[model samples]
Target: MRSPKDFFAPLALGAPEPLREVPFRPSRMIHFFDPSNERMRAKVPDIAPTVDVLLGNLEDAVSADSKDAARAGLIEVGKAWEPGHTQLWTRVNSLDSPWFLDDVWALCHEIGDKLDVIMVPKVEGPEDIHYVDRLLAQLEARVGLERPLLVHAILETARGVANVESICLASPRMQGLSLGPADLAADRRMKTTRVGGGHPGYLVRTDPVPDGDDDARTSFQQDLWHYTLARMVDACGTAGILPYYGPFGDIADPIGCEDQFRNAYLLGCVGAWSLHPSQIAIAKRVFSPEPAEVAWAQRVVTEMGDGTGAVMIDGKMQDDATVKQCRVVLQLARDLSAADPELAAAYGLETA
Candidate 1:
């Protein structure tokens, strides 16, 4: 095992020098659909066209009896799916579960070439990632796979959140980390019964009125996930991997879900999970930068010309740092445009 000094040395070098060049396809929103659900499974072909990432979920929501079926369904889907811009991913059972071994063994041997990422659940530390990494490498070597499959960890436990930075850097094959709020709340012993959104019970109480008016307002409720989200953003940013907001279980409250996702997006999360079909459009809309913001970024790039020095924009100072920010948006726009032509047009990009 590598020492702590080695574990942190790469981050100390900084952001891996911006990848030399960006990938052609945009990874805006990773839409999560349960392959075990007949309705969702039936919609996969139709859904794949609209989303940037199509993930077949096998953990959490799938019933125990249906685990085998989900595995079979995913294998069939992976085999039948032709290469496309939309990347294919699957969330496997957790390492502790009876099903996880089979999930990995079958997937690695059967559809390893077709799969892009294997989402590992409840990852608590670097050890968890190391296990998956070694296993995946072994599997790839056995199958004579040309490219290594990537791994994504779900940061849900308190220990997982605390160890996120190390986990992100545990392996070169680590792709990203996602917030799993439901399991996190349970793991942390949080009192709220709600999944991943603001709860009145979890809020601060208002002060009592001097005149004894019970209806008087006091302190307002703040986001419960503020610290976790910020910490996750910093960890992911530091490690050069992407961070994502997990699913908001209250599918009926699309507005609240959007607000939660927007908070994560503003805080530097690259994408979010969409549990229901209704949640997909909300995620796609929230995670992508607004056209006004994108247009302004484009203007800044155009104004800078050479992208080396500072200048004034709307009487405000713009510099190399600001231009770098603009490039972030431009890269995202270009990637999204490549992935979905309709979405590209909606964002005012010229679609082919």
Candidate 2:
């Protein structure tokens, strides 16, 4: 069995060196909505209060002809948005795209103070982050901004996945990494046509039973994202940056989406993306620890006192290793409480 030190070593590496001295806030769900969409844009103000993070998407879903419109729309939306506990973020066009340069230039110059994070898509390596880092630094300096705007890389390309570590460590402004499944699947030439979930055809079957025995039943529905998500969790965990599961395209199938997000959450992901309004609650529900789990963790900490040595809880063993898990929940509760008092109360936690 591994020691407590070995299990907790990942936390040290996974956490980025504290920069800007900003208070650690719980970004449980980074909600994505198209800024160019009139319906979505109209909903932003109300949406801002409900979600932890609200992102204005200017890429992928936006039309070629509407690139300029999307840019303007994001700026207008950013200018008008009153930053409450909800952080303001924007997903710019990919670095390789023609619109990206203008996207960065416009957002930085127009609403640098308002924006919290600039989500850079298809980040293949550290070089992509370096370029943006330098440009953002220059922009921040020009705007006379106090704190530098953070960057969140989208792990979508095959090259990006291959170079995730370098990208995560490329800049102090690198806040987190988000797994972009659809683009990654396309980039990797994956067989599955569906976005971000298990595929029934992509699985292994049991071998035929030996002589005279009945045919054995087999497993069904393989997790197509297992390899990628595991690698992503390892990469982010090792780097001290946050790991998030990307969007579930089938908004109608909340069950499958919840399953995917829950898998990521259990694998140590901090959060997941919610593309539609319906997905917001699912992501929030899955990402946070259960009440029973939280209460149990609290009991362990309360009983352990100094947090050293073995103890029995409900006839199960818990030691220093369990304290770390308890701390994880307590820390999340503390962070969430700091971010939103109402949510803290909803979870029955006292606001700090």
Candidate 3:
């Protein structure tokens, strides 16, 4: 019954990580595709450029029977992906599963150089991350790879949420964490059927409909994932890693998906997962800072002159705090536009 945090405390104390700092990667839409599916697998090259990150999903989507096939398919597709334009990531089967070790072993040995990040799902605590970190280091050494592979944790289970801070601080290879709302809801046994969205039943009624028919009642729907999302954002921020919002399963309702992504973005998430092709655009749009916001931020930053003393901008206070917010928006805009040509065009960025 050792504490999860103590397991990695020695490394966290003062030791420098063997892994190099990963490149500044923008993952506005971590597009998910099943490598085992021929139709989806074939479209990687063409569709990859359209999204910031292309992920070969070998977890929940791939059945038990197709695990082997999915592993092979993922290697083939991952090795062939264009490195500079899009990040190649994979969601390996959970560590608790039988295939987990094999998936990590083969992926690192076979395609370690090609893969940018390996996402671990249902991460419960720091111990889970420490295990993968050790194994990945060994595999990377075995393959003679120059740069180590990065790890992304999916905070789905309730235990995972509770221990996210330790999980993010577990390793230098830790890239970020994404909210798996579907699994999270199920893990919590929440009374909702929809995936990654607000439930009408989980709402606030207006004084039980005063002076109106009992049946004629209305309530304002509230975001179900707000608390978890905010918590994840803060945890990731403290650890100097990124945070992302996972998919919204209702592919038919793009508006709802956009709203969910926007909520996350406003609350400090850098991006979200795009479950379907259509969601790619929504994620990109919602995650990127709007033109006006970016402009205002730039103005405030320029006026502040080194982000110090207070000033007035359009009758509003502009101080150290306001400058910091402005910098966040501007920095995010720069990152998103760097990888997205369409976004660069919209941002009026000139190319080389």
TM-score for all models, in order of appearance:
0.88, 0.90, 0.92
Candidate with top TM-score is 3
Q: Comparing candidate 2 with candidate 3, which one achieves the higher lDDT?
A: 3
User: What shift in Å separates residue 243 of candidate 3 from its native position after superposition?
Assistant: 0.6
Model 3 C-alpha lDDT versus the unseen true structure: 0.85
Candidate 2 lDDT score relative to the true structure: 0.81
Q: What is the lDDT of residue 298 in candidate 3?
A: 84
Residue 307 displacement in candidate 3 (angstroms): 2.3
lDDT accuracy of residue 163 in candidate 3: 96
Can you write out model 1's per-residue Cα lDDT over 1-352, one digit (the tens) per residue? 6774454233222222112212335556788877776777788789888777899888888899999989988888888887788889999999999999899889988998999889999999999998887677677777667676778899999999889888987876777888888899999999877889887755676777788877667767789888998898898777777888887989889999999999998898888888777887888888777888888999999999998888999998998999999899877877677666776776788865
Q: Estimate the overall C-alpha local distance difference test score of candidate 1.
A: 0.82
Using TM-score as the yardstick, the better of models 2 and 3 is: 3
Q: List where candidate 2 sits over 4 angstroms from the true fold.
A: 1-23, 211-216, 340-343
Tens-digit per-residue lDDT, 51-115, candidate 3 = 88899999999999999999999989867765777889999999989999889888988888899
Cα-based RMSD of the predictions, in order? Answer: 4.7, 6.2, 3.4
**What ranges in model 1 sit over 4 Å off?**
3-25, 204-214, 346-352
lDDT of 2 by residue, 1-352 (tens): 2253342221122232226432456677899887777777888878888888899889998999988988998898989978677889999999878999899889988988899989999999999987887677666666666667888899999999899888887766778888898999999998777878888888776676658444455766778888888898888777677888888889889999999999998898888888888998998788877767677778999988899999998898889999999989877766766766666776678886
Candidate 2 residue pairs in clash (backbone atoms < 3 Å):
14-240, 15-240
